[model samples]
Target: MSLIITDECINCDVCEPECPNGAIYQGDEIYEIDPNKCTECVGHFDEPQCQQVCPVDCIPLDPNNVETKEQLMEKFVKLTAKS
Candidate 1:
């Protein structure tokens, strides 16, 4: 599943740089995760890097954008190809 940044985000700018897919961005209010670009760091790390660094623990799996691990890997491959 992809990750989502809730209203709890502090906009501390820590999570933005930790996202390997660059899915996290400065939204109008809080940091937003673009599901299209979010692989949950499957291609790059063992766990979601943003979640690890976020102080408020606002990052969570996006149930609305859920995907299987295999599906996430496929998306990661596609994203890697674009680079």
Candidate 2:
């Protein structure tokens, strides 16, 4: 359920608005997602909106931060509870 952005990002800022969980952010030079906040859009959408709107398809699964659906739900819970 993890997600990440690759270097293929063009910095076009197209994918930022598509995020439902507010996980995507402009990186120092590329875009990055806070793994703790990314829920793969499980709670808010059927698919990862960021990837769907990305002009370059730079957003992809984060191999290093892989998580299960249960974990993704947990992350969503935590993120919503933080406020």
Candidate 3:
């Protein structure tokens, strides 16, 4: 699954830099995760890097944008190919 930044986000700015897919960005209120670019760090790391550094732990799996590991890996491949 991709990740979502909740209202609990303090905008610490840590999560934005941690996203390998560049999925995290400053939204009107808080940092938002772009599900289309999010691969949960599948091709880059074992775990979602943003979640690891979010001080408030606001980053969580997006139930609405859920995907299997294989699907995430596929996204990762597609994403990397563009870069």
Whose lDDT is greatest here?
1
- Write the residue-wise lDDT of candidate 2 on 51-81 in tens digits: 8888788888999998999899888788778
**Global lDDT scores for all candidate models:** 0.93, 0.85, 0.92
Which RMSD values do the candidates have, in order?
A: 1.1, 1.3, 1.1
**Worst 10 contiguous positions by lDDT, candidate 1:** 74-83
Stretches of model 2 off by over 4 angstroms after superposition: none
Show the colliding residue pairs in model 2.
Answer: none
| Backbone collisions counted per model | 0, 0, 0
TM-score of 2: 0.90
Tens digits of lDDT, candidate 3, 1-83: 89899999998899898888899999999999999999999989998899899888898899999899999999989888955
Who is ahead in TM-score, 1 or 2? 1
Q: After superposition, how far is residue 17 of candidate 1 from its true place, in Å?
A: 0.5
Scanning candidate 2 in windows of ten residues, the lowest lDDT window is 74-83
Estimated TM-score per prediction?
A: 0.96, 0.90, 0.96
Worst 10-residue stretch by lDDT in candidate 3? 74-83
